[model samples]
Target: MKIPIQLNQENLQEVGSRMPIPDYNREADNTGIVHIGVGGFHRAHQAYYLHQLRQLGEALDWGICGIGLREADAKLQDIFNKQDHLYTLMVKHSDGKIEPEVIGSIVDFKMGTKDPEPVIAQMAHANTRMVSLTITEGGYNFNPTTGEFNFDNPDIQHELKHPQDPKTVYGFLTAALKRRREAGLPAFTILVCDNIEHNGDMMRKMLGTFAEAQDPDLAKWIAQEVSFPNSMVDRITPVTTQTDIETLAQKYGVKDSWPVTCEPFIQWVIEDKFSNGRPDFEKVGVQFVPDVGPYEKMKLRLLNAGHSVLGLLGALHGHPTINACIEDEVFKNYLRAFLDKEATPILGNIEGIDLTDYKDSLLERFANPNIKDSVSRICAESSAKLPKFLIATIHENLAIGGSIKFATLVIAAWCYYSDKEADQNGQAVEIIDAMSTDLHQAAEQTKTDPLAFIRQESIFGNLIRNERFTKLYSEVVHKMYKDPNIKKYMRDMISIE
Candidate 1:
C-alpha cells in the first residue's frame, strides 16, 4: 500500500511531480484579497484564477485570505490551518479524466464565528485592496422579488444594535470600512462573486442600507469611496463527496481533508471597475467588460435556469444526478427546447456570444458524467434560485409576449416536488429550502386552490396576477397531481408555443 502524503507546505516536494503545487512563495504579508464564504465554488472559480495567474509568476501579492462567518466553517478553518491553507482542486473532465492540482492562492483563513476581530482587522488592512464574496444567493439578506434589503434579518438587527462585535457579512464589512475610514486608509473594493443578477450593485445597496442605519456619515463615505463591480461567474462545482477524498489519497497519494472537485469549463466576466488596484486578471482569461448586464442576463437565464429546470423536473422523475437527467432523451430534449425556444429568445443580442453555440455547450456541460452533480444539490435552495433563474425569465417573456410554457412547467414541477416530497419511484426526496415548510403548505393547497403556490406574493410577486400564467400554471399543476408522468408532460410541453 502506498502511503498518502499529507498536503501542506512542508510536504510539497514529497507529493511528486504528477500534481502541480505552487511554484511561487505564498507569503502572509502579501495577502491582497479577503474573501468571505470560502466554499467550494469560490475556491474552484475565483481562487483558481489567481492560482493560474500566480503560476505565470504574476500577481504574487494577490494571495487570498478566506473568511468563514458561520460556525460550520470551523471545519474549513481547521483543515486550512493543518494544510497551511493549501488544498487540491480535482478537475473532472467529461471523458473521465481527472487532473489534481494543489492551489496555494488562499494563504490564510479566519474564523469569524468565534471572534470577528481578526476577520474585521484583515479586511481593514491597507494591504487588502478587495473583499470578494460568494455567500450564496440568500446570503445578501434581501427580498428576491422586491429587490429590497431585509433589515428585519436577526443578524442585521443584532449588528445594528451592537456594531462593535460583528455578526453578519454586512456587519463585518461595515466595521472594517469604518476602521479604514477612521484610520485615513482607502476603502477596499467590494467584489461580489455570487450568482445573482447585478451582484455588485446588490451588495452596494444592501451594505449601504446597513451602513446608513448604523451611521449616515459612514454610509455616505462608503457610497462615495467604495467601488462595487458587477460580475458573472460560471463553473459547475459539485459538492465534494467522500469518494472524491478517498480517490485523491488512493490515486494521487495526496490526502486533502477538504478538496474541491469541478468540471473542466470555467468563465468569469466582470465590469472593469474598482476602488483600489486589482490583479491583472485580464491576462488570465477573465473578461473585463464595460458592462456585465448582457453576459449576466444570458448566464442567469440559460445556464442557471436550465439547471433549475433539470433539477426540479429531474427530482420529480427520480433522477439522482444532473448527468442522469441529461442521459434521459426526454429531459435533454426538454432542456434544449426550453433554452432555444423560451430562454434564448428573451435574451437580447449578447455581444461576442453565439446563443446557439452557448445553448448547445450548456447541454454538453450538464451531461458531464464524471462531475456527478446531484439533483438534490441543485434543488437545495429552490426558493432563492427559481426567483432569479427561472421566474425572472418567465417575467421578461411575459412582458415581451415570448413563450413561457417551458419555464412555467418547471415552476409547476417544483410545486409537485415540494408537495410530494417523494419521487415517482417512491424514494423520499429531500426538500431543502429556507421556505420548505411554506412551500409544502402552499403546494398542498393546490388540490383545492390551484393558485396557492403562485400566491406566495413575496416569492411569486404578482406572478399570480397574470391571467395567462395562472391559467397555464393551474392546468399544469392539476395534470401533474393526477398523473406524475414527468417525462411525458415534458415531451408534450416541448412542442407548445
Candidate 2:
C-alpha cells in the first residue's frame, strides 16, 4: 500500500475510500446528533472519535450533521462540497512522522442561518439524540468573570426574540429543548467540548440562564430533562495555511482540498451520562469518569494555563513559535517555575495524575519544533481564555493564602502583550478580539493607576475586588511597568543561580 504524493480532493477520495478496509458509512442511519461550530478542532477530535466508533460498529446508528452558527456557514459549505463531506486528517508527530487518515464522521452539512427553517425543524426529529458544541469559549457569549449569560449581546437579543430561529448557540439549544418538552420527547444530552473549567456546569448555567429568561415552564423542563455532560478535549489543530495545502499534496501524495493536520496525541475525558443514548467510546481511548471536575481542572490549570502564560509572554518577547518560546532559556524557566511553584500548589493532587510527569510531557509537547504553532494564534480571545487558564488558578491559590506571584507575572505579560506596537522584528501585530480596543484603552490607563489596568470587569469579573489579588497584582504591574524590560525582569526573578 503505497501512499500518495499529492493529497488533493480527487486523489484523497480515491485513497481514503479504500483505506482501513471498513465502510462505517454503510452502518450509519442519521441518528440525530447535531454538532454546532464545526471547525478544525471538532473535525480533528470529536468527529474523529465518532468515525472510529462507527468503524468499530458501536456508532453505526449515530452519524453527525454539522451546523454552522453565525458567518461560519459559507466557508464550511465550500469545503464540504469540495470533498463530498469527506476530509483528510494528517496526524503529525514530533518524531517527524505523518499518518494520513480519512475521516468520515460528517454525513450532511447545513448553515442553519442560511436555511433556518429546515434546520430548526430537523432538531425536532425523534432520532436526534444529542447536541454537541465546540463553539469555543467566546461562542457561548458568557461573561468570563461572572460566568453568566451575556444577554446584552445583540445577537443573543435577536435569538431571544425568535427562539426557534436561533441567532446564538444558547438560543438554539433552549429552543430545541422547548420543542422536545412540548412533544413529550426525552431531552437529549447537551455535550460541551471546550477548554473551560467545569465545561458542563458552565454550559448548563448558560442554558439555564437562557431558559429562565425565556419562560419558567421551559426552564423547569430543561432542568429536569437535559443533562450537560462535562468533557476534556485536547488536540493541537492549528489554523490551516496555503503552505499546508502545498505540503499535503507534495508530502502525503493525496489531494485533500481541506485536510486537517494535528498532533498524534489526543485525549477526551467524558461523563457517561446520556439522556437518549451514546456510543460505546470505551473501546476507543475515551475515559468515562464519575466526575470530570478533577480531570478538567488539571488540564485547564496546567496545560491550558501554561499555554497562556508562555503564549502571551512569548508573543510579548517576540518569539514566533511555541517551540521557540519553550526553547528560550528565559521563557522556559518562567514557565517551569510558574507551573511547579504556583499552579501545582493550587491544583494539589488529583487521582491518577502526577504533576511532575504531566508538566514534563506538556513541556515536550510545547517544544515540538515541527509543530510551528504560534503564540499569537493560540493567544486569541484572551478575555475568554484568562478565566480558564489564569484566573481560576488565582482564585484557588488565594483561598489558601498561597503566593500568586507567578500568576501575577502571567497577567502582567498579557497586559504588555496587548500593548506592544510590533512583533520581535518590528513587524506590526494584529490584535484579534472584540475586546482588543477596550484592552488597549485599559492598558493606556496603567500609568495613572496600575490597578485600573488590571481591573477589566469583563475579563477578571469582580475577582479583582479581592484585597489579596489586587495587592499582589498591583506590585507586579508597578514593577513591570517601571522596569520596561519584563523579559530581563522575569529572567532575574526566576534565577536559579
Q: Which candidate is the best by TM-score?
A: 1
Worst 10 residues of 2 by lDDT: 19-28
The TM-scores, one per candidate, come to 0.99, 0.93
- Decoy 2 TM-score against native: 0.93
Off by over 4 Å in 1: 495-497
Give the alpha carbon lDDT tens digit for every residue of 1-497 in model 2. Answer: 33543322345445755443226653235656888888889999999998888887677767888888767567877878776677777777888877777787787777777657555655666878988998888787777766667889987788777776677777777777777788988988889998887888888888888888877789988888888889999888877767767676676555666778788879999998788888788788999998988888888888888888887777777788788998888888888888887788876678888889989998988888767787888788887788778887887778888767777877876776666545434566778876898888887777787877668887876766899888777777778766656687687668743
For candidate 1, write residues 1-497 as lDDT tens digits: 46799999999988756588889889999899999999999999999999999999999788999999999999998999999999999999999999999999999999998888999999999999999999989888999889998988888889999998889999999999999999999999999998899999999999999999998999999999999999999999999999999999998889999999999999999999999999999888999999999999899999999999999899999999999999999999999999988888887898899999998899999999999999999999889988998898888889999898898988888888888899866789888899999999999998899999999977888999999899999898899999988888998987554
Clashes of each: 0, 13
Candidate 1: the clashing residue pairs are none
What's the lDDT of the predicted structure labeled candidate 2? Answer: 0.78
True-structure RMSD, every candidate: 1.0, 2.6
